[model samples]
Target chain A: MSELVKVVVDAMGGDYAPQEPVKAAVEAVTERKDIQVILTGPEDEVHAQLAKYPDYPKDRIQVVPATEVIQTAEPPVMAIQKKKDSSLVVGLKMVKRQEADAFVSCGSTGAILVGGQVLVGRLKGVERPPLAPLIPTEKGVSLLIDCGATVDARSSHLVQFAKMGSIYMENVVGIKNPKVAIVNIGAEEEKGNALVKETFPLLKACPGINFIGSIEARDIPSGYADVVVCEAFVGNVILKLYEGLAGTLMKKIKGGLMSSFRSKLGALLIKPALKKTLKSFDVTEHGGAPLLGLKGLVVKCHGSARSIEIKNGIFQCVQFKQQRINEKIGEHILEMADTSKE
Target chain B: MSELVKVVVDAMGGDYAPQEPVKAAVEAVTERKDIQVILTGPEDEVHAQLAKYPDYPKDRIQVVPATEVIQTAEPPVMAIQKKKDSSLVVGLKMVKRQEADAFVSCGSTGAILVGGQVLVGRLKGVERPPLAPLIPTEKGVSLLIDCGATVDARSSHLVQFAKMGSIYMENVVGIKNPKVAIVNIGAEEEKGNALVKETFPLLKACPGINFIGSIEARDIPSGYADVVVCEAFVGNVILKLYEGLAGTLMKKIKGGLMSSFRSKLGALLIKPALKKTLKSFDVTEHGGAPLLGLKGLVVKCHGSARSIEIKNGIFQCVQFKQQRINEKIGEHILEMADTSKE
Candidate 1:
C-alpha cells in the first residue's frame, strides 16, 4: 500500500457534530487502507459515537481530545483567538504543525477561514487564499473560486484565483485544459463594474490557462466553463443564491406533484428517476470548500453536513494530498512570478 | 373613465419587434378604456402589423413614425447619441416632450436606462434611477431594485433604492408598508463588504420605512422581503441566475419525465396541473422592470417578451400613472432631504 494521508477531522463542528464526524471517519478508514483519520473533540463524546462502529480499523483511526467547542455565531477572529483548545483550532494547529496532511471541518465557515489563514498560513507568493467549491452544473461540475474568503479582493487577486482554479479543476477534478471564466453581468467585454472591468484584461493576459472571456450568470448552471472566477462578495452571493433557489424550486416542485390524486400518482411513477436526477444536483454529494493557496490543506464542509458529505470531504482531502495540489500551486505561482519579472 | 395614460411603445425593440409590440398595443386598448398607445417604428411596418387588428379599437392606438432601430449589442452611450430617429429615442423624446405619460420598451436595457436618465430625467433629489422588477416568489412578487441601472452604487444610492422601492411597492403593488431588506452574504449586519456595511446602519436609521436587517441571498426566493435591495451587479446576477436556473431545471425535468415509459405516461396525466403551477412562477407574468425615479415613467420589458408580457407592461404603466408613483417618489425624496438637513 501507498503512504497514508493523515486527515484531521473536527468532531465538535457542524449541525450533526461528533456522531456524523465519527461515523464518517469510520467509513473513510474502512473504505481505504491508504488513509488515516485523527478525530478531535471532547474525548467521551467522540468515544461514545465511535463505540457504535466497533468494526472500524483500529490502527487507522486515532482520537485527539479537545474540550472546547466554537459556536458558529461567535466572531471568527475572536473564536480562533480565545478557543485554542476547540476542535476547529486543534485540527488547524495539527495541519500547521505537520502532524496531519489535511484538516476537514463542518464548522463555522468564518472560523475555519480565519484559522486556515492565520494558523496554517498562505503559500508563498499567494496574494490571498480563496475558498473554492465544486458546484454541480448541467454538463458536470464547475469550480467556483473565492466564494467567501477574501470578500474585498482586487483584480490581481482575481487573476490568481483563475490560475489556481484552473489548476484545481485540471488536476483534482481531472479535466484537461479546464476553461476559466470570469463571472460578469454581460458577455460583452466593456460591461460590468470597476472590479470586473479591471480583472477582465488581467485574466485575459494571464499565462498558462484557458481564459475564456466574460460569462453571464445565466450560463453558469449550463456548465459553460470548468472554472468560474470572481471576487468573494459576488461569488458568495452566487453560491448562496444558487443553493437557495434550488431548494425553493424543489419544494415548489414537490408541492405541485402532490396537488391532485392523478398528479400524486404521476409523482410516484417519476419518483425514482427524479430523485436520482435531483440527488446528482445535491451539493453535499460533492465535498467541502477547500481553502486554496494555504501551505497545508484545509476543507470547510457545510454546517448541516451529514455523514455522507463528511465522508466525501475526507476523500476529497485524500485526493488533494495524493495529487500534491499545494506543491503544484506553489510551483505555478513561482512560474507566474518569474514570467512577470522577465 | 379616468384621464388617459399615454404610453409610447417601441415597435422596433425586442426579439419579436413590431409584431409583439403592435399586438400588445391593440390588446391593451381592448382590455382597458383609460389607456392609449403610440407605436413608434418605421411607419409602414407599424401600419402593416396594425392592419391585422383592423377590427380593434382604432381610436385608442396611434402610429408615430420613426425611421431607425437600435440593436441590443450596440454601446448604450453611442447608440443614444447617434440613433436620433430610432424607435427608442423617439419614444423617450415623446415622454420628455410631455406628449406621452410613459415609455414602454422591450429594447436594449442599456439604451433605455441611459435614455431615461438623459431624456426623461430624474426627479429632484433622486440619487439614482433604479430598474425595479417584480419577481415571482412563493407568497407573491417582491420588487428587486437596481437589477441593472447602477452597478457600482454608493450607500446613499442604496438607501434611495430602498425608499423608492418601498414607495412603489406600497402605492403601485398595493402592499402596505412593504418589508425592505438588503441582500448580503450573511444575515448579520457586519457580515458584508464596505458598501453593504455602510448602507446597513443608514437603512436601519432611516424613518418611514419598514427596515428589516440583512437578508442572505438564500432567503430571497422564500418571499421573506417585499422589497429586495442591492447594487446593480449583484442584483443583475441574482435576476439572470434565477431565470437561467429555472429554465435549465425545467428542461431537465421534461427530460426526466420522458426518460421512461412510465414517466411519459405520468407526464401526460400531470401536465395540466404542472403547467398551471409553473405558470404562477413565471416572471413575465408579473410585468417589466420600471425605471423608478424618472420624471416620466419608463418600463423595460424583457428583450424576449411576447404579447402577454408587453400588454402587462402597458397595464403596469397605467397603474403607475393612476397611483401617481413618480409624484409620491418626489414627495418622499423631499421628506428625506429635509430630515437629513435637520
Candidate 2:
C-alpha cells in the first residue's frame, strides 16, 4: 500500500471548533484511504467529538494534545511565543519536524502567519512568505498571491511573487504556462505607479512563465487572467471585498425574495436551484490559502470555517503533496536565480 | 423657487449618448423645477432626440454646440488640451468658469480625472482630488474616497481625504457625523503600513467627524463603515471588485433560474421583487463619483452609462450645490490645520 499522507489539523481553533474540524477530518479520511489526520487539541474534547462520528476509522484518526488556545485578540508574535501549547504553534512544529506533511488551521491568522515563518521557516531566496489563495473565477479559478501576509512589499518581491505563483498554478493547479498578470490600476503597462511599472518589465522578461501585461481588479472575477499578483495589501483588499460583496448580495437577494407572499412562494419553488448555484460561489469549497514560498506546506482556513471548509482544506494538502508543488517552486526559483547571475 | 441649479452635462459622451442623457435630463427637469440642464453636443442630434419627448419644457433644456467627441481610446490629456470643441472639455470649461453649477461625464474616466484637476483646479488646502463614490451598503450607501485618482498618497493627504469625505457624506449624502475609516489590512491601529499608521492618529484627533479605526475591505458592504478612505490604488480595487462580483453573481442567478422550467416560472413570479432588490445593488442608481477637493464640482459616471445614469449624475450636482459640500470641506480643512497647530 502507498504511504498515508499525514495532515496535522488544529481542531481547537476557529468559530466552529472541534466539531467542524473533527467532522471534516472524518469525512476526508473516509473518502480517501491514503490519508491520516492528527487532530491536535484537548484530548478529551477531541475524543468526545470523535465519539459522535461512529463511522470514522479508529486507526486513521489520532489526538495530539494541545491544551492552550490562541484567541484572535492576542498579539500575533506575543501569542505564538507565550502560548507554546497552542494548536497553531504545536501543529506548525509537527510540520517542521516532518511528523506531518502539512499543517491546516482555522486559528488566528496573525498567529499562523507569525508561526509559519518562526517555526516552519521560508524557502531559500524567498524574501517574504506570501499567502496565496485560489479564487473561483468565471473560467475555473485563478490564484491571488500576497493576500495580507507581508505588507509594504517592494517591487522585487512582487516580481518574485509572479514567478512563485506561476509555478504553483502550472505545477499544482495544472495550468500550462499560466497567464501571469501584475494587478494594476489599468491594463496599459505605463498606467500604474512606481511599484507596478518597475515590476511589469521584470514579469514580462520572466522566461519560464506566460506573463500577461496587466489586470485590473474588475477583470479578475471575469477570469480574464490565470494568475493575479499584487502586494499583500492590495491582494487582501481584493479577497476580502470579494467575500463581503458576495455575502451582502446573497443576503439582499434572500431578503427580497422573502419580502412578499407571492415572492416567498416563488423563492420556495426555486430554492433548490438557487441553493445549488450559490454553492459554487461559496469560498469554503476552494479550501484554505497556502503560505507560498514556505519550506513546508501551511494552509490558513477562515477563522469561522465549518466542517466542509476543513475537508476542502485537507483535500488541498493532498493535491499539494501529489503535485510536489513546493519542490517545483524551489527548482524554478533556483533556475531563475542562476540565469539572473549570468 | 430656489435659484435654478444649472448642471452642464457632456451629452456626447457614454455608450447611450443623446438618447439616454436626453431622456434623463428631461426627466430630471420635469421632476425638479429648480434644476436646468445644458446638453452639449451637436445641436441637430440633441433636437432630434428631444423631438421624442414634447412634454419636456423646451426652455428648461438648452443645446450647446460642440462638434467633436472624445473617444475612450483618445489620450485623456491630449483630448482635453487639443480638442477645443470636444464635449468633455467644453462642458468642464463651463463649470470652471462658474457658468454651470457642476460638470457630469460618463465619458473617459482618465480624461475626467485629468480635466477636473487641470481645468477646474483644486480648492485651497486640498492636496489631492479624490474620486469619492457612494457605494451601496446595508445602511443605504457609504462614500468610498480616492476610488481612482491619487495613488502613492501621503499621510497628510489621507487625513485631508478623511475630513473632506466625512463632510461630503454627511452634508451631501445626508449622513450625520459620518464614520470614516482608513481601509487597512487589519483593524488594529498599528496593523497597517506607514501611511495608515500615521494617518490613524491624525484622523482620530480631528474634530467634527466620527473617526472610526481601520476597516478591512470585507467589512465594507456589511455597512460596518460609512466612509471608506484609502489611496487610489486600494480604492480602485475595492470599487472594481464590488462591481465585478455583483455583476457575476447576478448573471449566475439569472442563468440558474432559466436552467429549469420550474425555476423560470418562479423567476417570473418574483421578477418585480427581484428587480427592486437588484436595483439597490446597481451602480448607476448611485450616480457618478464626485472628484472631491476640486475647485469646481466634477462627477464621473460609468463609461457604460446611459441617460438614466447621466441624469443621476446631474442630480448629484444639485445636492452638492445645495449642501455646499465643497465650502464645508474647505472650512473643515482650515479647522483641522489650526487644531494641528495647537
Candidate 3:
C-alpha cells in the first residue's frame, strides 16, 4: 500500500466519549488494514480504554494529545476560537492541514458545523454547504440534503444541492442515477410557494440529474424518491420530525408490550426478532450526516453518539474517500455553474 | 333548548361514505340531544344506510336532496363550480346561507378549502384563511394553524393566525392563555427566516394572545406548547410528517411483535392497554381541522375518514359552535387590523 488513509477522530466528544469512540476506533482499525486512526484526546484516558481492546493493532492506532473539551452550552464560534487545544479544534486542524483524510466528531453540532465551514472551507463554485443525512426507508436509505444548514436558501443553492447530492448517493450509496426531488407542499408542479415554484422548473431543466417532480413529506417514509432536496429550514423540520416521532412511537410500543403478564410472556418469545426489527429503524445504525460541497470530507456525528455511531461515521469517510466523492462533486458543481453562466 | 345545532353532512364523501357518514350522523345525533344532522346525498343510498339504524330519530336525521358527488380526483375549483348539486357543494352552501350551524365533510380537502373561501368568503380584516388541525400530544391536543391553505403567508397573516388559533384553543380546547409558538428553525428568539423574524415581535406585542417563543418540530410531540403556528407550507410538512412517521412506526412495531411465538403471547395480554394508549395518539379522535378566520365555521375532515372520525368531527362542531370560535376570531382580527392602522 502506498499510504494508509489516516482518519482523525475526536475521542473526547459526545455523551459516551473516550469509551464509545475508543471502542469504535479499535473495531474500525481492526477491520480495515489500509486505515490508520488518530484518536485525539488526553493520552492516559485513551490508553486505559485501549487496554480493554488488546487484540486491536496497537501500531495502527496512535494518540494525538489534546487537553480541552467543548461543551454543548458554549458559544459555537467563540469555543472554536478560544479552545484551540480542544479535541474538536485539533481534529479539524489535522483535516485542514492535510495531515488526515477526514475529520470525525461526535461533539457539539454547532462547533462542528462552524469549524467545517470556517476551517476546511467550501469547494469551488459551491454557494452553501449542505448537511446530507441518510435516512432509513423501507426500500433502504435515502439522502435528505440541507438538513440543518443554510436555512434561508435560494433556488440556485437548491439546484446546486440536487447536483452535489446526486453525485454522493450514486458514488458512495451505490444508487445509479439517484432520483432527485424538491420537497414541497404538494405533489403537483405548480403547487408550492415562491421558492418551490421557482426551483421546480430549474430542477426539471437540469439535464445531468434525474429530477423527479415534487415530493410531499408523507411520501418520504415510503421512500417515494431517492434524493429529497430542500432549504435547511424545511429539511431540518423533516429530519427532526422523523427523529422525534420515531422515538415517541418506539417508546409507546415498548411501554405497551410490557404493560401486562401475557404481554410480558409474549415479549420473551419474540424478543430476538423484535430486537432485530427495531435495530433496523435505529438512527444510530446510520452514520453521521456528511457536510457536502466542502473541499474535503467532514461528517457531524450526533452529540450523544456512542461508539457504534462514531465507527459508522468514520466508515462513511472511508467510502467517501475511496470513491473520491469530493473531486466528483467539485467537478459536477463547476460544470453546472459554467453552463449557467454561458 | 334553543334550536338544536344543525350540522350538514356530506353523505357521499370518503371511502366508506353513505354508510360511514350516515352511521356517524346517526351516532352523533343519538349521543348528543342538542344536535340535529342533515344528510346530503342521493336519496336511495342515504335511505339504504338509514334502514340499518331503525332506532335513530328520523326527524333529527333528515335527508337533503343532492344528486352528484365530488370525487377526490376532480379539480377543486372546477368540481366546486360544475358540481353545483354535489353533496359537498350543497352541504357547504347550507352553512354559508346560515341554514346549518356547521358543515362536516370527509370529502376532497382541496374542494373544501377552495369552497370555504370562494363560497363562504373570509371574515373581514382576515388576510388569509388557515386550516387549523388539532394534533394529539402528550399533554393534550394542540391546534396547528395553516396546515394546508395560504401558501405565501406574510407577517400580518401569521399574527392573525396566532390570534385566531389562541382564541380557538382557549374557548374550544379549554386551555387558558394557550401557549402560542411560531414554528421556526431554532428555539431562540433571534432565529428563523424573514417571515418568522418579522412576525415574532408582532405576535408578542398582541394583547390577548399568549405568545410563546419559537418551537422546533422536535418540541411538538413533547407538548412543549399548546398552539403551534406556521405558514401553510411548513404546517403541511409538520402535519404530514406526524401522520407518515406515526403510521410507519405502528406498522413496524406490529410486524416486530408478530415475528415470534413468545412476542405473540406477550402482545395478547398487553393488547388492551396498548389499544387504549394508541387510541389516544390517533388523529381521528380529534376530528376535522377548522378553516379559521372564515366568515362561517368550516371543518375539513380527512378524505379517508371512517365513522368514528366523522362522528368525532361532528361532535367537534358542537364545541366550535358552543364556544362561538368564529365570532371571537373575527372580532380579534378586526381589532388587530384597526390597531395596526393607527
Best by TM-score: 1
lDDT tens digits by residue: candidate 1, A1-342: 778999999999999998898999999999988899999999999999999987978899999999999999999999999999999999999999999999999999999999999999999999899999999888989999989998779988998899899989988999999999999999988999999999998888899999989989999999999999988988998888888888888888889888999999888888877887787777778989999999889998999999898899999888899999999999999898888799
Error of 1 at A139 (Å): 0.3
Please, what are the lDDT tens digits per residue for candidate 3 over residues A1-342? 545877898889888888988998998898888788999898889888889976878898989989999987677899999999999888888888888989888888778888889988899999999999998776778899988878779999999999988998999899999999989977888688899999999999997999989998888887788899998888888888787777766566567667777666665766786687778877667999999987777888887888788888888998899898999998888899889889
True contacts kept of each: 0.65, 0.79, 0.65
How would you encode candidate 1's per-residue C-alpha lDDT over B181-209 as one tens digit per residue? 99998889989999999999999999988
Interface RMSD of each: 1.1, 1.1, 2.1
| TM-score (second chain) of model 2 | 0.95
What's the TM-score of every candidate structure? Answer: 0.99, 0.96, 0.93
Extract clashing residue pairs from model 2: B20-B307, B21-B307
Candidate models: Cα lDDT each: 0.92, 0.87, 0.86
DockQ of each: 0.75, 0.77, 0.59
Name model 1 segments beyond 4 Å from true. Answer: none
Q: In model 1, what is the error at residue A199, expressed in angstroms?
A: 0.7
Number of the top candidate by DockQ? 2
Which model scores highest in lDDT? Answer: 1
Candidate 3 residue-wise lDDT, B1-342, digit = tens: 755888999999888888899999999988989889999999999999999998977789979989999998788999999999999889888888989988899888889999999988888889899999999787779999989898879988888888888899999889998999999877777677888889999988988888878998888887788999998999999998888777776677678778766677766766786787788888778999998877677888887888888888898888888888888888888888788889
Candidate 2's docking class is medium
Candidate 1 lDDT at B10 equals 98
* Worst lDDT 10-window in candidate 1 chain B: B244-253
